[model samples]
Target: MEIQHHVSLKHYNTFGLDITASELATIEHENDISILSEVPDFSTQSLLVLGGGSNVLFSGDYAGLVLKNNILGKEVLKQNEEFVWVRLGAGENWHQVVLWSIENGWGGIENLSLIPGTVGAAPMQNIGAYGVELSSVFEYLEAFELKTGKIAQFNTTDCDFGYRYSVFKGPLKQQFIITRVILKLSKHPTFNTSYGAVAQTLEEMGVEQLTIKDISSAVIKIRQSKLPDPAVIGNAGSFFKNPIVANETLNNLKTEYTNIPSYAFDNSYSKIPAGWLIEQCQWKGYRKGSIGVHAKQALVLVNYGGAKGRELVDLSKQIQASVQSRFGIELIPEVNIV
Candidate 1:
């Protein structure tokens, strides 16, 4: 294993914080995972496995060993008339996978087009966009247990996927490193365009016939128009998850705010848009010394340039506090702060 010390991680993360890792290693193959336990001070230092680094916020220099998952592959394991099972390596780029699926006429992840990050990370957070989520197509995933150094398989039920949450982020946090993801895509897909401006965007695009490719293009266009590109501007997509509040809380807010937007989460709960709450608090387009909330999307926290992770974390906390005070709904961060 090649280990580097004091490695700058600005490029690794989408937030572009110039943090350093105490030690860094690359997991380019499954064999690399077996010997990670033998690395210098492996048992003493904390371990962090990074995929595409699109969903993480480093609060400061990572005072631990950072392993970048570079193991890459995409293959169709099996296929029938209805479904095609595709297995991807942990490091496979998510959007590229969507494009690849579209090329092969496979459908399911088309609506998730342009979502940044890696395949292995998808199951951890149950990545979603438009009206579709990873759980709807997830088959299973293989992971390497850190303690045992053995590979184990987990099915959809075992994952326990919830809204932007999975068991990996909870009970099994830091216990295992996901290595592979298996998804069952459809040969003939049932398109979902009811979420957001997908249908409207498709109509504007002058698309008369709807296909998986058309939906992907529309979702990509909508995302591009609303979200700032990380390549040009530093951002980690939506920094906060929409808070799910009690139906009673929603009714109480409606009486005062009168324009509170919500979606049905369950019979007893409703999901409030975090962006609307932040915007109502006058945080949209708010910037302070190279760090601030994105103007177009309040859910995104961007680093204009030369900003520290600590500042980012502080801003997120402030936004959370503001929303909680104004609406009595606590906003949870979707970004994993390390």
Candidate 2:
């Protein structure tokens, strides 16, 4: 473990906002966390378990310890003709892991390629893309309870994954730090290309006989062309989650705005595209001072250099208010505002 004091968090988070942590430490191995309880100062200071920091917004200097989970490894735990169980350390870069699996001829995570964040945070948000979510491949996870300093393992059912939520974000919130995740992937893969622009992108590219690597490459290209790289412009990719509404509510909205885009979620509910709502309010190219919505993806709020976290939060609120006023729908922010 390497510890530092008075650390700047600008580089840690995708938002590139200037924030400070009172103390910061990096745990390079998963087992290293077992001894964290003996670090002497944890009980006295609040701690933050951080992965890639792609999903968080630090509103101000953290008056606590920021423990960056740097443990890294990937292993095939079990394999057979039909399926394989793979385990990943908490700190692995998510996209790198996807690429690794695809290169190894594994198929489950191909559609989820190019999502920003760490593997540990994947189960927490139920991170999904191109029509597949972490839940589809989830097997189990090992986490360390913060209070008791004990390790616990949870199965898929224990995760309680729904949409973009999980037990890790609710009943288990802040109580544990995920150290490893186990995922089950197929030996003979089934492709998932049902989500937005995937089939279209493939058709446009005149592709057939698609392999996992090809699908991942397609997603990577599409994402690169649309989303601004956080390395170039500061942003936490989609800032707000698409809100789900009752079927009747969606019908009413559609009656008023004929072009409203929605997808059915069973007979009772429909998921509304938050990006469309934000764009409907003409917020795509909207800007206020140092913060603004990304021109291409209205759901992504960007830091136009030198923006404070507070400014970003205020801008997000403004968009939320505008969308609610215009559409009678509440847009919930996806970024974890700290």
Candidate 3:
């Protein structure tokens, strides 16, 4: 564990905010956690842990220690005829894991290709795309508890997984740092191509015998067409979670806006596409100064070059206010603001 002082965090987050941290430390090994706790004044300093930094926004310079989780490894723990259990280090890139699974002929995560962030953040956000979620493949996770300096295991049930959420994002927020993830991948996969433009994109690709690679490529194409690359610009994929409303609520809105789009979340609720909602309010491509909503995808907010986290936050608020005022639905942020 190496700790540095007065570090610029511009390279740590997807938004590329140029903020400084009073101290920054890198945990490269599981033992590093114990070593970190033994550092001088480690107990009193406020801690901010970062993974791939894809889902985080730094509002300002951090006044405490920023721990960058870079613990990396990937291994197959066990396998049966039907399923294979893989152990991934927390700091491993999530998309790489998907690619690894594909390379090995593992089937389940093909629809989740190209989503950014690290494996540690995957379960915390319960990252989903093209109708597949981390919870579907998740077996369990091993978290390093800061308070006890001990490793604890949490299964899917313990995670309390939901849409863009888990126990780590709720009751256990910031209390423990995830160090490892165990995924249960299928040998024979059932493809989910109906969500969003996956099916249409697959058809466009002229796929006859559908394979995991084909689905992964299709999803990648669709996402690349819609979402902006954070490396080229600056963005946190989707800024807000798609809001779920009651059947009656959607029906009431349908009376006014006949073109309103929705999907069945369950029997009682409907999931309204957040991008559609934002676009209808005309916030898509709405740029001001440095920060603005992406033209290609309204759900994404971008920092042109030198935009701060505050500016993007303000723009998101404006978009939310407009969407809420127009449709009676609240837009909740999926990204974590620090």
Candidate 4:
């Protein structure tokens, strides 16, 4: 374990916002966690657990310790004729795990390729892309409880997954650090090619037969073209989640905005595309000072250069307000604002 004081966090987060932490600690292995409970400084101090830092925006300097989870490993825990279960270290990069699964003929997470962040953070937001979510393949997760300093394993049901939400971000927020996640993948494959531009991309590539690897490759290519690389320019992917509305409310909006793009989730509710709503408001390519909506994708908030976290939040609030006033829908911030 290496502990440092007053660390700058500009490089850790995808947003590239410079923030300071009073103290920073790195635990390189899972066993190092056993010694964590004895550290009075943590309970005595404010603490934040950070993974790959792709889905968070720091509002300001953190007043206490920032625990950087460096623990790493991935292994197939169990396998049989019917199914295979693999356990992943929380610190492992999520996209790497997806690639590994595809390489090994494990076929559930191919659609999730190229998503940024660590495996530990995946379940926090039930991270999804295409038509698959972590919850769809989740077996269980082992988490270390912050208050009790004890270990607890939560099954899929315990995680209580919903669109862009899970127990980790809700009732259990900041109460646990996920150490490991188990995923049940398939030996027999099922491919979902129905979402977004996936089918079109495949067609353009002249791909007649698709495998898990092919799907992963296509998704990666599509994502790279749409999202700005955090390494080049600063961004945290989609800033707001697609808002879910009651069926009645959706119908009412449809009357005024007849071409509103929506997908039915259940009999009583529908999910409207937030990007479409923002674009309709003419927010795309709209720049306000140093912060602006991504010219290519309305849902992505970008840092043009030297923009502060508050500026991003204010712009997001304006979008939220505009969407609500115009469509009678409240947009939810998907990026975790710390």
Candidate 5:
């Protein structure tokens, strides 16, 4: 394994934040894990396992080792009459995996098309889009334990998936480096086009007979129309997770603003769209220097050109404070701030 010092992280992260890592190592294969764990500073210093760098913001220069996961492979492990079990390396691009599934007639992850990140990061966030989530198709995953240098497999039950949350971001945080993800995908397509603009986009595209490919195409279209590409505009996708509030709170907010949109979370709670709240707070299209709320989608925080991660962090905090002050809802960032 080659370890480079004072590595510029500008190209590593999708946000285009200019930051430096004290030591950076690239893990291209599973064998590299043994070598990396043997580094003298590996256990002594702080560590970050970066995938596609789509879901993180560096507050400043990192004073530790940054391991970039580049492990890549995809294979079918088993198959049944109804489903196909496939395993993929953590480093594979998520959208490409979705496309590969669609091409092979696997139908479970079609609604998740166009999401930016690596497969390894998907389970960490329980990534969801258009009424479907990673938990819906997850089978299990193999992770390399940092302390023991042993591989551990976790099933769906072990993950403890919640809205934009998983054990990888909780109790198991920084404890394991996910090496591979095993997914159970459907041989028969179950179409989910109910959320957001998916159905409308499908209609616009004249998709009368729905297929998994069509659903993926519709999702891609909707996402392209709403979210800005990180390559063109520096961003980490939806900066905040949609906050779930009590039913009573929704009713009270509804009394004042009847058009306040929400989805039923459960028996006593409703999930409010953070984007709507941010827009209502008048932050949408609001720019100050290089940092701003995305004009098209307020849920996304963007770095226009030369904005630092700290500036974006401050902007997100301001948005949260404004939302809480206005609607009594505290928006929590989905993006990991380091």
Candidate 6:
């Protein structure tokens, strides 16, 4: 394990907020977990287990130890007639994993293509895109318990997955460091192009007969068109979770707005698009100082150049306040603010 002090975290997060960690360590192997636990301040100091840094924002310099997961590997564990079980290291880039599955003709994660982050972070938020979520393909996971220094395993039910939420982000938060994820992907592809602009994008690409690859390509194209690349403009995609409201609330809103867009979330609930609500507030393309909402997608909050983490956070709060005032619905942040 290599440990450093007072490390700049500017490049560590996709949001590009310049901050520092008082102490930082890299876990390149399984043994590093044990070594990390032995640190003098392990029990007393603040600790954060980080992956690709794609889904987090640093409000200021992290006060304690930051363990950066660098564990990497991917292997097929077993395969049956219908599905193949594959285990992936926590630190592996999510997009690379998606492309790898596509290259191997494996299906199930095609709709999640181009999402920035690491495999370990996926389960934390039940990462989803297009019409599919990680829960649909999750089989199990192995993690290192920080408190006991033991390897623990959890299945789908143990995860307690909800839309963009999981036990990892709840009861198990900071309790274990996810080291590996096992996914059950289909040998036979079932394409889901039902969400967002997927079907329209596929049609525009002239994809009459769809394959997993085709679906992935269409998703990539649509995302690229709508989302600003982090390399160019720093951002964590979809800063807020789509608010789910009672059907009666939807009816009331529709009576006044008439153009409200929503999807049936359950028999009694409907999911309202956060992007639409933000756009309705006239925030799209809105800029102030070094932070702003991306013109192409109001769901994205961006760092134009040198925005501090706290500034971006304040901007998000402002947005939330505006949306709540306008629609009487609260928007919850999807991005983790440190």
Clashes in each model (backbone N, CA, C under 3 Å)? 0, 0, 0, 0, 0, 0
Candidate 6 lDDT by residue in tens digits, 1-338: 67899999888899988899998999887789898788776878889988879889899899999989889999999999999999999999999999999999899999999999899999999999999999999999999998899999999999999999999888888898999999999999888978858988888899877899999999999888878999999998899999999999999999999999999999999999999999999999999999999998999999999999999989999999999999999999999988
Instruction: Estimate the overall C-alpha local distance difference test score of candidate 4.
Output: 0.88
lDDT of each: 0.93, 0.89, 0.90, 0.88, 0.93, 0.93
The worst-scoring run of ten residues by lDDT in candidate 2 lies at 28-37
Cα displacement (Å) at residue 191, model 3: 2.0
lDDT over C-alpha atoms for residue 231 of model 6:
96
Write down the worst ten-residue block by lDDT for model 6. Answer: 35-44
In lDDT terms, how accurate is model 2? 0.89
lDDT of 6 at 199: 88
Q: Counting only residues 3 or more apart in sequence or on different chains, how many pairs clash (N, Cα, C under 3 Å) in candidate 5? A: 0
Q: Candidate 6 at residue 156, lDDT?
A: 95
Tell how far residue 15 is off in model 3, in angstroms.
0.9
Instruction: Report lDDT (Cα) of residue 140, candidate 4.
Output: 98
> Candidate 6 — which pairs collide?
none
lDDT of 5 by residue, 232-336 (tens): 999999999999999999999999999999999999999999999999999999999999988889999999998898899899999999999999898999999
TM for every model, in the order presented, reads 0.98, 0.97, 0.97, 0.97, 0.98, 0.98
lDDT per residue (tens digit) for residues 1-338 in model 4:
77899899998899898888888888776666668668766677777899988999887888988889877889989999978999899999999999889888998999999998899999999999988898989999999887887889999899999999999899999889899999999999899998869988888888877888888888988998988898877899999999888999888888888898899989898988999999988899899777889899999998877889888888888998998888777889999998
RMSD to native, candidate 4:
1.2
Q: Candidate 6: deviation at residue 64, Å?
A: 0.9
Judge candidate 5 against the unseen true structure and give its global Cα lDDT, from 0 to 1.
Answer: 0.93
lDDT of 6 at 10: 86
Could you give me the TM-score of model 4 versus the true structure? 0.97
Please identify which of the two predictions, 4 or 6, would achieve the higher TM-score against the true structure: 6
